[model samples]
Target chain A: MNKPGNLIGWLRKKLNGISRLWIVECLLLLAFGAVGARLVYLHAGPNEVRIQKAQDASEFTKSLVPFRGRILDGSRNPNILAISLGVHDICANPQMLTAATNTELAVSILSAYLKMSKEDVRYKLRFSDKKFAYVKRFVTRDISERLWTQITNNHIKGIYLEEATLRSYPQNNQACHVVGFVNNAGVGSLGVEMTLNSSLTGTAGVVKGMRDGKKHEIYTRRTEEIQPIQGDDVILTLDQQIQYFTEKALDDAMAQHSARAAWAVVQRCRTGEILAMASRPAFNLNEYGAETDMSRMTNRVLSVVYEPGSTLKPVTLALAFTEGLVTPETMFDCENGSWFYMGRILRDYHPYSRLSVADIIKKSSNIGTAKIALMMGDEKLHKGLRAFGFGRKQGVELPYEEYGILPRLEKWSGLSCSRIAIGQGIAVTALQMAGMMSAIANDGFLLKPYVVKSIASSDGKPRFTAEPVVLGRPIDSKVAALMRYLLARVTEEGGTGTRARVEGFKVAGKTGTAQKPVPGGYSETAYMASFAGFLPADKPEITIVVVVEEPQPYHTGGVVAAPVFAQIAEQTVRYLNLEPTEPVEGAPGAAAPAP
Target chain B: MARVNRKKNTADQQIIPPRLILTVLTVIGVGMGYLGIRSRCEQLGSEIKKLESSCEINQRRLENEESKWAGLMTPRSIEEALTRHGLNLTWPRRGQVVRIYDSRANDLALVDMKDAVRFAELERVALNE
Candidate 1:
């Protein structure tokens, strides 16, 4: 053995290397345990929360648009006036679309699909720095499907589709004013579209889903999605057949007379339903934006107001008959078609020296009507006229309907009473005139005029319906009967409205040729020729009002407007199948419902 | 040269337990189970998304067909078609129609034609007055 100190020193030297190795091995084992612990924490601990948070951060919400409603006619064979069709708006995220991809190939395919030039497509794709861009809009269903297939098959990144709707008026311009059209921004701009827009455009839907950092939808992680609710449909009380016929008649009248404008309204006599309302200078709903003349877009049935001229004679005579002021056999001296009343010369188109009350209305004599008004006085005339649905909105389902001017009794001028008696001083709308005549045909009850019949929800269940609202009875049934009989005589031989007679049917109507009022007096040339009439006079079915503004060659209501009324009436009578009745024997002076 | 030569043989003689090996296998099996569940969840999400999109597309198609049918039946289009094909149809008159009356249905009497026919043909038809 060696010394103790020497032995200890030799053993320590050998263990020194081993001690360093053991320290390194312990450190290595500790690192492995720490790494294993970290892995477990990441995979099963707060990592799940982080992953969910990541998904939430990448999520986005999208809005889905709903379909707009349709407008349908009231005919048994309903025709669509306005409808909305589904379309797609082709869009792209510029950041993901054209960068680092086959730019040429993408541009070429999109260009062909969009019918755009490849250079244009490429330029648009390259120039936009925005994340989103509209490539094309209002893409049809056929083209959209093809494009969708192309994009999906080629895995076109960033290019997307947004659901959009397109409004279509298949009638084009026929009944356009009533159906109206959607604008470039898809808002209803006129007529029924503007009137009932809330019911037409439905509520939009929302969708919540997760997207990756690349703005790609993580389809599996969708949170919430809702289908959009579609809009309610509107059914109108307009008969497309009658509307078409009325439009055709007005169009022909406008062309023939070189008139500034023309309009017509046909209403069901008993129900007060507006069968048809049409105005000329109408624009196409499809190209409504291109229509430059603002006035041409006006629906003149309730908008335009003018003096009704001789048409007021029937109203005056009805008032007299209602008040027991005159009988059909009572005579009035017409002063040979001219008479000075309240410092104004009241004249008739034809000179009549003496006319019974029935002949006075049948001949539409101004002096006779003025004399009768003089007998009744101003307050009575005003009350009678107001009761006839004048100077009030007919409550029709249309926009901007006017209550035509009817000055109060206190505001009557010196000649107001006499002049108004001849349909000159007062003004009335075409719809009002039609409604007034319909009341007479409906046996004296003034029914509120309405166009929209019902509104149905998206599921085809009716949400609201309109029933006939009777305003009031302006006359007794007996007086209305006498009035109808007197009106029938106006369409007989030697009467002014003989041109308005329909074959196989005894027609009843009055002619009004109102001279447009100038600054100081009436115009010598400008006139509104109008005829208000009903057919099968014994039992009236429909009332028609035809007005032609400023006829060129013939300016009289009898010549210009009466023939148009005849054309419309004949067709309508045939369409409605009104049977021929035996002509009542009156001998030119009898009234009182042919009793 | 080294005193550790005999210690190695003893260390090498010790063997791993079956339970420890089973534990290792169980950890691997749990990891694979998590992967399988995650993959299945992703697949189900994709299928749901596809189904939703399909439902939406079908709704769109239905709406589109309704619009098409309505547009095709517009009066102007129908009139154009009628004029284009030279149909030249007109409304039938009253005389052109023949009435096949059912004696059981008294409601079939012609409208606005009662007085003249009823009074004149009273003795002609064998019916109670």
Candidate 2:
């Protein structure tokens, strides 16, 4: 305000000094601007590189996604014994949650939905300075949706959801032993699940996205993603209908006989395919946690071994006939129903004064069968048993199959040989008995019993198909036919297995009444009654074995096991629509064929 | 020379201002928001697909259970299952049976058979008796 030209002389001096000071200030401001620009360039250069590295890290993590597969049945029906369903893993940052209003309320609400304790939830929310912490795992879709709604309505912050898989079993207990179950991490635990786990569990997928300072997804900076590849499907050879029937039957028998346990198997003789197999006291696959006992988990049809009893007599008779040591007409004196052989008094159920080889089998005479075994000797008997698929595993694909006990010839005593001849000393599994019976039904050709028919990939292409493997043909076709004739007579009126006679079909079968061994000798009260047979003796098809343990009063094979065989055979014949060759003259044509 | 100077002053007054560049930048900002919305919609679509697949898996598991339950519920399946386990259904015996016969024989014939059936009176019995 002072400088108009008036104080020109004084103003000039002051203006000159101020001008110099202004020039110096101008230079200082330019220097400061240059320094600021340089600092900005330095900071931005490193930040750009850091941002690029972070983007690459996200891309790397996203590439590891894998896909899971499906499970199917023999009919190509989806078994889905275990499956992966989409779920969410919920997480939160406790420190950030502290600022959230009604924090305790939020924790309680989440804990209730997640099935966790409020204290646990609160503790997780309180102690976490880490950017992320798991609040809950395996949250279902419904719960997750409810959580989302809660978040939206309440404006909750610091919550997140991560994709995960939860396994489910559809057919809870149906075919549990066969279909098996999975573990917590979606790993197969048993049966088909364990067998085909590698192909069924899929790879996990990932997505790379920029997260905010709180690790929240940034809408703008999201980038690369990789999708999970789904696993291939496994198709089993189990027939659901047959399996259900088998299980039901076993359950009833176990209850009826007051048996400690029981097992049964149905096999197609020609194909060696196990149609149905069941053991009593089965468990549900869904609630495996309820019963984790090892005994209940076992598939007894393949694992347990017991004396096959009189059911095994047919194999001995067949072997005797095959080796030309005996024929249908060969007679042996049963010594008025009792005989002393190898210091063991073997007795017949009936005092058949004299019995031909065929009659010996029809009456299930222990004395007569022992005589036949003595004639064949131990070497030939052992060879014949081995050839019939006895004393060996059936080579089924399932785990934990037993090779039933068969003492070598060198280990056999005089009494042991005779005892084994009547099916006393040896032990056999239900599956082994079925396989042996299958050999007789299959024209003396023993086959490897297999439950799984085929395994297929997800696309329905068969990865593997089971072919009929002939273990051995122990006897000739003629011998098998002769044995079948002899067995059929056992079911005739007044014969041992009169109870096993079916109405419209000629059933060939043998009965077994094995006394359970006690501390000293045999337990008089406890018995294992079993019946193994094939239908339409002339042209055999299905081979079945039924074993019942500890019947109340009538513990004989003919009394307990034979009746069960008749019932199953009757129903199965009707189920398969097997045409009867010898229909009764006045009987109604079997069951009318299903349309 | 005077005319040229007036023309130059008019030209200076007509020159456009540079402040309009900010309007272009604002348009770009709006475009970025629209793109963000579009990408979010696409992401949601993919998530829906994944969820659909998961639903299918669950449905299949339920179907398997239903089929098993159906099999167990059927009467035939139950009966057959019982038989398989070891319970045998017994047929009616003679004690349980009621036999009804239609009699056509005369009483005289019954009397004659009774008299002839006796051992001691065989020789003494008359035809009338």
Candidate 3:
């Protein structure tokens, strides 16, 4: 109700009483309230989002690598065939490296320690735009330590190491095909490595954590962690010494005979464990990456098949003997080493008019064997061969093993019985031949062969252990005894396998010299000479088979294969310290003692 | 109103409460203790990191030594060493071995005396051949 001028003056008077200090205080209070409200919003409402934002800024996740397993031989004190050694992959942050002071000095030091060219090191280290590059991979522990010391002492920037593993074969190419090599991607590529890859490769782990401002992991802030598991170790049944002996003998024979290729297998007769299996043209595991020839990597003993020639004679004769069709004294007219049966001509290495069953085996008379097979006919012979584990895989631990060709009974042709009986028109692997010999040595029990002895985990827990598996009993124990007796004479005086005798022990064996089949007919020049045998015929300990492919000049089994067999058997018996069962020829205890 | 004002002034003039002072002091002490524990945890974490790295280095070193040992034990290595030393060692032949029979009293008898002599002759003949 007062006048406008009076009201204005009164308002001015009230405003003038309020000081600037009061306004400043009011502004400060407003700022504090705003700050408190923001804190409440972050700490109380939707706090998880703020926490997640902070973690995203500083947290990191890393994968942990697992260690691969090892392969060892089955010696009393096992030899390591393959192993995985921890190594480092030398890496660099090239952007930081290029910006680092004294970059040339660091490059020179790295090159010297890494044993690489200076240009390579500089090229890897001088990329200013790149964040990371590999300076070197799989650097050994010794070299990595030296480089680490240099880096720390000289304050070299951006150079770091990533942990990894390198698969190594200490024995080089000695058991190359048995203990295969690992590829660059940390995977097993061949042999036992390929077959047992899963157990040999372990599981990796994960670790998530928060890193500090300098990009260093803050271990206390680790959110999650898992421990990696190591792979299992595989132990093979090979004896290193015996393997050495067999390989050495085979090498010498290959050179002596000018052979194209050679392979051999040594097995324990009682237990079907392969002691040594060697093939020529083997590739070195350490240098497998450089090898280009596929033939050299082939394990011919288990992978290749050929006509077994006369080696199958003993099997046929054993079947005849089992069916009570013939005895050691049973006589057969050998037709003077030539006979016609089912419109096929059968001939012997020697022309014998008449021979006992035992002499037929001793002299390797094909006509006598065919006549015996004619008596037994197709049904019994086919059943007997199948029972000897011919048509199927032996289920050995090796990879890519072929089941050698064994025709079925229904597939047999008119001349199948006589021809198959003489070891023609039927194919067999060297392993199959050795198994057949082992069956006889085991008293007619056909045992499955295996090379891997045991597999154990990193914690010493057994994963797999091999036990001798009896596949089948083909012949009776009595027939097996008679077969062993007749086969023993094959290595005695006037026997075809006389060269296979071990100076002081009786050897039971068969010799085979098969012509390599060509397009239209058999090759007259190329032959597979093989000898399959066991020592101390009465109580056999070891069974050995040696096959030499395409030997020149001398192609007969006794000439090319038996001597190698003799050398191996002699060395094995001496190495095993096997007590001599027979006296020396001129020893006082011998029937014909020295004067 | 004068009486009320006098009561308020009296209350304001009283000494600061000991419980309030203790509470303020305890809050500062707890903050300082939290700082101390946090710093100790960081220091221990750094030490653990260093120890873990050293452990990894030592593990690599041990693996290297083991691989070297295995390589040395291989037959090829042994044979190379023997050849380098010019040692032509060979296993004894069967003719060179002598059998000894043991009895209950631990009495050992050498068997095949005549055979041993004959073996020597045979070895001589083999050498001649």
Best by the DockQ measure? 3
Query: Taking the tens digit of each residue's C-alpha lDDT, what string does model 1 give over A291-311?
Result: 899887899999999899888
lDDT of 1 at A149: 92
TM-score, one value per model: 0.80, 0.74, 0.85
Extract clashing residue pairs from model 1. none
Per-prediction fnat: 0.20, 0.00, 0.29
The sequence of per-residue lDDT tens digits that candidate 2 reaches over residues B54-88 is: 78657545544554555455445566788999988
Kindly report which residue pairs in candidate 3 clash with one another.
Answer: none
lDDT of 3 by residue, A203-275 (tens): 8889999998898888789899997888899999888888888888888998999999999999887778888
Off by over 4 Å in 1: A1-56, A90-136, A146-161, A209-223, A578-595, B1-48, B93-129
Task: Give candidate 2 misplaced runs (Cα > 4 Å).
Answer: A1-60, A63-68, A75-82, A87-164, A202-229, A584-595, B1-129
Best by TM-score: 3
TM-score of chain B of 2: 0.44
By lDDT, rank the candidates, best first: 3, 1, 2
| TM-score for chain A, prediction 3 | 0.89
- Higher-ranked by TM-score: 1 or 3: 3
Candidate rank order under DockQ: 3, 1, 2
Residue A285's C-alpha lDDT in candidate 1?
83
